[model samples]
Target: MHILVVDDESVIREGLARILEGDSFTVDAAKNGHAAIELLQQKQFDLIITDLKMPGMSGFEVLNAVKILQPDTPVIMITGFATVETAVEAMKNGTVDYIVKPFTPEQILEKVHLALEQKKSTVEDIVVKKEIDCHHGFDEFVGESREMQKVYRRIIQVAATDSTVLITGESGTGKEVAARAIHKHSSRRDQPFVAVDCTALAENLLESELFGHVKGSFTGAMQTKMGLLMVADGGTLFLDEVSNISLSTQAKLLRVLQERQVTPIGGTQPVSFNIHLVAATNRSLKAMVAEGKFREDLFFRLNIIPLELPPLRERKGDIPLLIRHFMNKFVEEVGKDVRGISPDAMHFLENYSYPGNVRELVNTIERAVVLCEGDVIQKENLELGEAAEVCSTGFDGFVPTNAEALKEMKRHIRDRSVENVEKAFVIQALKRNNWNISRAAEETGMLRPNFQTMLKRLGISVKDYFGR
Candidate 1:
């Protein structure tokens, strides 16, 4: 550890440096606060020992400078004139401890060790708290794969700005979770976070819900209601499954995005709003725009910052981490004694494809925790259903007249079966990802070029799957 000694007297400064250096600490001596401040700006110190009364700048000034520059470093005040009030003042100014002048070597050493230990404890506490916050604050997104790391980086990058974000992913792939994470990390974190499910309400009701309504705007509009846009003023408004919004509502949403103003159904004046918009969708807004089903202008406005979340299948390496997270969560919630999953059960879970993504994994673990009778969760505790079944049906009742014919027939059957399975696998991945070739390739854990090569070999046209 490195320490800085600031004392106007040469003998005192040199003595403190020698004592600390003898104890295996690198020491730097400064005649006054200005020199100490200069040294602080140039290098980092683990601790600062400054005399309370100095020539030009006092120890209080040094303490204040240390607080501004390196608040984590502990400061110890030493002085010839020591009193209860001075000690109290030093403590209040953020000094770790104070020592009187003409002190013994043992006294100085004991105070330095105690201050360093306290600083270590404080730092460790902060680190542990940050780790806990990262898990719970980010909604328990337990993954460290390259794909997840990319998503994390993107979320952080966009969260610093007010740019509109469009999150695209399959259902249950945590689009809303990503939106919440963005909001949590943004400047408006302390403000409200209003989430609206666009698929939940009808066109008129959704409009009223978003744009608010004056009293008597419609048959059931008995009272004036504040819209989510107004509710999320100075905060964030998350629109979940924005692709389900009607074309007319889409036009109004575009206006809101463009003008930052909202007009109620029966009100005349427009209510201005300052809100961060984050929209999520499982469907393709680009395709919808091409088909005229969605407004192209609105799509462009919402697509300023696009974040595509990779499916769970694409980052299978993170499955074990996610499983452990879910297991801990469900075990606590269900009040079960389930401590772990059997090796066989864990292997099955890791290999089984999760079509519904993380949400499905969460459900599976919850169910297993509830059904597990012993301390460990076995394969029988999991209810994967049809997803767990492996195809093993063999040709039956087929007899050939000769050995050569039988051999040829078997070869043809094997080749046909392999081709069918491969085609089905590719098609399923494509279907799951809305026919996006890149996404399909990622979901199947294949490189884009390799996936495209397979598509060509299989004679599969991506355009054919569009709008399906």
Candidate 2:
């Protein structure tokens, strides 16, 4: 870690710098707080060790300035008159730690280590919290896609309202996850988020599961049981694959949505419940209604505000993010010290269609992380099974050097014949993918609309390339 040492005393500064250097830390020294601030402006440091009694700018002033400038970096204060009140005031002024003067080198280093550790922990916490806030509850929802942005905005807008929501998307598009997010972000976040796969259980069990049942209601009913709806009262009920629910069950559910009550099996009294209903289906509900497989009125009841999660192919830009997220999760689960994925591995990940959507991508990364032995995950570590050759993106097994990076940047800037940067990026992606638009789009993590724009800008004709 980079450490900045600030003190007016040359002897103290030189002594501390020697100790820190011995500990293998990169050190920057300044005789006063003003010099320290100037050095900080030019470069980033992980921790700042400043003497509280500096002449030009006092340690308190420096701490306040750093708090405003780079709050993530921590500052530790050194004081000769180490009073409880002074230490507390220094802490309140944003000093991560306060050390007494005449401290051993070990004591100072220990405090610096603690400060850096806290800073790292704080950064990780912020990242996870931001993800949870963005996704509501599930971290599976990954996107910077314009369509996904609209979906996120809609979710936030409708979360506070107790409207019945219908989530529609392809099978692997994370509809159930979206349902949970709505519930988590809603007023009833503390209550249960009950999910029932409408197609998994038999009709009789499904009805009993949702509406509850009294003792001796059915052949196997030995005890009174609360159904999913009542359990989810004050929260949300997610009905997955809602189109598959039997017509009879649909009618019963529609009544619950309409009247906010559930009648236990073979019971006369209808128990009142307050719940937000969220239903999801891969099939087109409108088509199902026309085909008499789904109830039109029930569809109307659930379709008050719809949220459709885009397919993986539509938001391929999130693959890198999803890969990193899954890698971190797997590292925690498996207790591994793997550093990162190889460039070729990332290329392969970016190109695949991921027909199973984000779930498929996550599973793929998790599997790679678990099977890999080395510090970095490589292309050979992944067992894609049938997905191996589906990538359109190129893999050159290149690890970038500073000279290569500079050359690539200069080449990129000069390539006006290839179109603007976005288009050129797509063309470079196509070159990587062997000129396959579909694969190039996947590799570049561009959705079809954005990919199409990329190709048009690059003077590429899909018809000419694919003979479509």
lDDT scores for all predictions?
0.84, 0.78
Clashing residue pairs in all predictions, respectively, total: 0, 2
lDDT of 1 at 106: 85
**Residue lDDT tens for model 2, 143-243:** 65566777777787778799889899987788887887788789888998999998899999999999999999989999999988899888888999998
Per-residue lDDT, model 1, residue 403, is: 85
Off by over 4 Å in 2: 1-140, 387-468
Each prediction's RMSD over C-alphas, in Å, is 13.4, 16.1
Off by over 4 Å in 1: 1-138, 390-468
444, model 2: CA deviation in Å? 18
Q: Provide TM-scores for the models.
A: 0.60, 0.57
lDDT for model 2, on a 0 to 1 scale? 0.78
lDDT of 1 by residue, 134-245 (tens): 5443454777667877888899899999999999998888998899999999999999999999999999999999999999989999999999999999999999999999
How many Å off is the CA of 97 in candidate 2?
33
Measured with C-alpha atoms, the lDDT of residue 396 in candidate 1 is: 26
Deviation from native of the Cα of residue 205 in model 1, angstroms: 0.6
